[model samples]
Target chain A: MVKLAAKCILAGDPAVGKTALAQIFRSDGAHFQKNYTLTTGVDLVVKTVPVPDTGDSVELFIFDSAGKELFSEMLDKLWESPNVLCLVYDVTNEQSFSNCSKWLEKARAQVPGTSLPGVLVGNKTDLASRRAVDPAQAQAWALGQGLECFETSVKEMENYEAPFRCLATQFLHLYREKVELFQGLV
Target chain B: KMKTDLCLSSEGTEVILATSSDEKHPPENIIDGNAETFWTTTGMFPQEFVICFHKHVKIEKLIIQSYLVRTLRVEKSTSKEPVGFQQWIEKDLVHTEGQLQNEEITAHDGHATYLRVIIQSAFDHFASVHSISAEGTVVLNSS
Candidate 1:
């Protein structure tokens, strides 16, 4: 089985459940902290996910960066040559969803001359009663941006693994494409 | 005593070893004293490089310019050879994002012939050290 490694960046506005989603995925829902300490810098976490029906696996190095506007410029350094992007947004906050485009632009700006594979995550799905962004609208935007969309809720452990699994699968596809191109050259 | 750039590559100071070396960003860039030129890491965490001074010197302070660096550990050795290292300073730096991490650390220590820097962790996969300048006076004592 082939093993691959990909650098995945989780980015969105502050308090949009970016950290919570990442923590839930990293700890496998074993730990969830109530108190929220603002992420001042980038937090690194690694997780390996097996592609469905495939013996291969992809180890994702997730770079969870702070969503504060003050730290936006810092994203340039932290987002260097990212293999995959997880653009997160709060379901209840309209502004957070609106800012997804800005975050995507920033992430794309880091790697010029190449298209980056990414996913748009509308987090806090458990807050459906207070949701401000309609799922159809978010999904439409994600599709326009050429990204697969997923909804997750760390509090409910709802679809928390879908986004990561999608990234791992896509990275494996990218790796295989590269190998094929090199083989054709030879 | 006049202060000089102790780690200047042009002055004949050498980088004895670097754990990871990229062809575009060589370890010599760390001592080049040019902020534009930088040395970048190619591998995992805990990357390091050793710099040998022309002679034993008292280090008063150090200024490091880098990008994506998180925790840095500095060690010094006074042996005739590049062995026997003692921890001199350890710092957890604040991330500045798009800008370079310009860190000025006070390193008051006795004469030492070698210095090693360990990059414990970075905010990203790769970290870059643009320049490292040591402001200090050379030791003239024969003993």
Candidate 2:
């Protein structure tokens, strides 16, 4: 049995669906709107997913971090965990999308020397008319950062599984590449 | 062994505020073998209650059993206005399971005369005192 560990960082502006995105991905169809009261410190959750090839499961620990200024100090500690990072933004709110770069920069600075794999998520895609962020702009930003970009709707449960699974797939690919390179080294 | 004569008159439990200026409403500790004690009828001030230590001690935690009282505030002895003291005090919401145990702490400067428990706010239900326990190591502060 493969015992793989995964941790994903949900980062973006406050009230940008970072928490909603994580919950929807973790528990499919479990839609809820708890009080938007700002997350005081860090809220963490974990889910286990199965790997088809080995019939084994990997634990995915998700950190729904606070996006407020008070959490700046904690940002550094958040990056030390070895896992994929989901830089989430609100599709309906352009300001959240614009602030993605700052979140990524702060996360990268936390783990200065490690190669981090991450994805950009434009959330709340169900609200097309209210969208303040343009898809093209988000895609350009993702391409520039060498990361995959995805637009998701947690409320509608649309494309929720794809983005998280995409991160898992990328992790496997990265692991395989490292193994191959190490084999050649021997 | 001691012999004593006892008399009983069916008087209902009397309840009054702990802050009554009248000596008749003075708070008294319920003793194990004594006349049945009555509950305080009057409500605690928005921020006022008296504290009496059984013995000299440094209080570490104080648990408050209240009912329908939603908010709490405590004030230092010198300050007239009540300041929020809920954050500094560590507590568990006793009211979570349909029971009431909302807690708060009064300012405990080295020199504290009256440790007051204030009722900042309340809900539809009247607040009732179930129990209040103070835990701390005994120290020689007062004779």
Candidate 3:
């Protein structure tokens, strides 16, 4: 089986659980940060995700970055040529959700003219009492922007792996298509 | 173990795509085994070029000769297509002014039918790749 390495970029608004979700997934929900500190340049993590039935795996080199232009010029260097994207936002904050478009635009600018396989993550779902971004509304917008939508609460330790698994599966699907296209050319 | 120069044009390796294509300096210069002739980037820091080996090869090592490039990333695809390329290696090159930056990298047994070389960032506005030579073995699979 082929083990491919892909550069996965994690981007979102500040305090939207980008770091928490990433740490949880990397440690298989075992390690969660108690105190939140501002992410400076970039946090690089490597995880191997197996494609379910295909027997292949994608080694994701995740570049979890800061939110909303925090030392953004330095971020541009780390954000180059992302193979997969995870755009996160807080469910309790409508303003953070609204800024998804801007985050997406910035990520896409790194690799111009390329369709980046991405997922829109609505984080902090446990904050239902303060939920501002509607699930259905976020789903519709994600669909319109060619992104798969998934809502999860890192604090609640629920469904954190779904978005990453979806990205791994999607990357494998793209690989299969390329193999077919090359075989067709032969 | 035998080592083969997998990036040679004589070995059926062809450069399929390049972000910068100058009339005088072409992308094919990288595989021609001549350091004097080179492929120069036109406008940006993240310029790239694709080299198709036409078959699956497990690249053991790669030697790249370039100028002014600071950060370089290499990706590959087993499908031999322009699509589905995945990251293989990335390096932060040290710039020594007035000379070519010769980088030799170990591939960690990277297998690919096509390889993409990306100049992610550079010390200057433009960078030139003098040559790229890879040592590897070809695998034959019929599936």
Candidate 4:
């Protein structure tokens, strides 16, 4: 079984619950803080996910970065050499959803001429009554951008692991492909 | 009595300890006096490093160039060996993106042979210290 490690970055606008989503996935519903403290820099968390049937595991070093524009320059440094990306937005905030493209552009710009695997996540699904971004629309945009899409709610603990698990699976697939290519060349 | 770069390894300064060390970005970069080179933290919070000068010096000001640094605490020791550190300065730094944080702090009473810098916290998962310049004159009488 192959054990791989990769850097995963989470980016979004401020107040969009980026930190909450990360905390929920890391703690597995054991911890949740009600008080909100603006993340001025990047918070690092690590988690391991097992690939089904293959017995291989991937350890993800997740970098949860601040969403404030004032910290945009510092954010770029944190995005260095990311293996996967998690572009998140608040479902109830259309502006956050609309800003997804901008965030994606910035992340992609960091690694020019390379295609990085990523997911487009619409968070705050618990606020469905006040939702402004339709899942279908978000999914369509995500597909257009070549990213898998998922809706999650940190507050409700709904499908919080889907995005991370998907990333791990995709990374493992890439790792296998690289190993095969090297073997074939030999 | 001209000002000298007291932290330079070429000038008899030594990086005694750094909690997190990456081969590409070694702790010596902090005193290299070059902004292009840097030492990056590998993991976790409260990463720290110790710098020992060849002799006791009276530091007047310190300029640190770094990125993603949130809270920084500095201490000094006058003993022959690296021990008995006393708090000199502690302050929170502002975060700026796409640019290095050039922080200039006035260190009024930094008379010591060893200086310790403790990064209490950072704005991000990892932080980088590009360079640290200590402007002061060496104390001739204080061996």
* Residue-wise C-alpha lDDT for candidate 3, range B1-143, written one tens digit per residue: 46799999988889999887655568898899887777776433478999988888889999998886889999998884678988999999997666778899998958888899999976643567889999888885323
Question: Model 3, stretches more than 4 Å misplaced?
Answer: A29-41, A66-69, B1-143
Interface RMSD of each: 11.9, 32.8, 15.6, 12.7
lDDT digits (tens) for residues B1-143 of candidate 4: 99988889888888999987656568898897777777776544578999989788889999988887889999999998899999999989997766788899988877889989999976654578888999999995444
Give candidate 4 regions above 4 Å deviation: A29-41, A67-69, B1-143
lDDT of 4 by residue, A51-87 (tens): 7787776677788764544476788777886778899
- Where does model 2 exceed 4 Å of error? A29-41, A51-57, A66-69, B1-143
Assess the local accuracy of residue B13 in candidate 1 as a C-alpha lDDT between 0 and 100: 77
Q: Each model's TM-score?
A: 0.55, 0.49, 0.57, 0.54
> TM-score of model 2 relative to the true fold?
0.49
| TM-score head-to-head 1 vs 3, winner | 3
lDDT of 3: 0.80
Model 1 misplaced stretches (Cα beyond 4 Å): A29-41, A67-69, B1-143
Q: Give a tens-digit lDDT track for model 2, residues B43-129.
A: 222423544432233455555555444565432222222222232332223333344443644425322222445555343212334
Local error of candidate 2 at B45, Å? 54
Q: lDDT tens string, model 1, B1-143? A: 88887879886678999887645468898898787777766534678999988588888889998876889999999887899999999999997756778899987764688999999977654577888888887885324
- Per-residue alpha-carbon lDDT of model 2 for A44-96, expressed as tens digits? 65665555564444455677765543466666565454457788899888788
Model 4's i-RMS, to one decimal, reads: 12.7
Q: Tens-digit lDDT track for model 3 on A1-186?
A: 555556788888889999888888887833322222336545667777878887677767777764534887778877876778999999999999999999999998876744688999999989899999999999999999999999999998999999988988887666555333322321
Q: State the C-alpha lDDT per candidate.
A: 0.79, 0.53, 0.80, 0.80
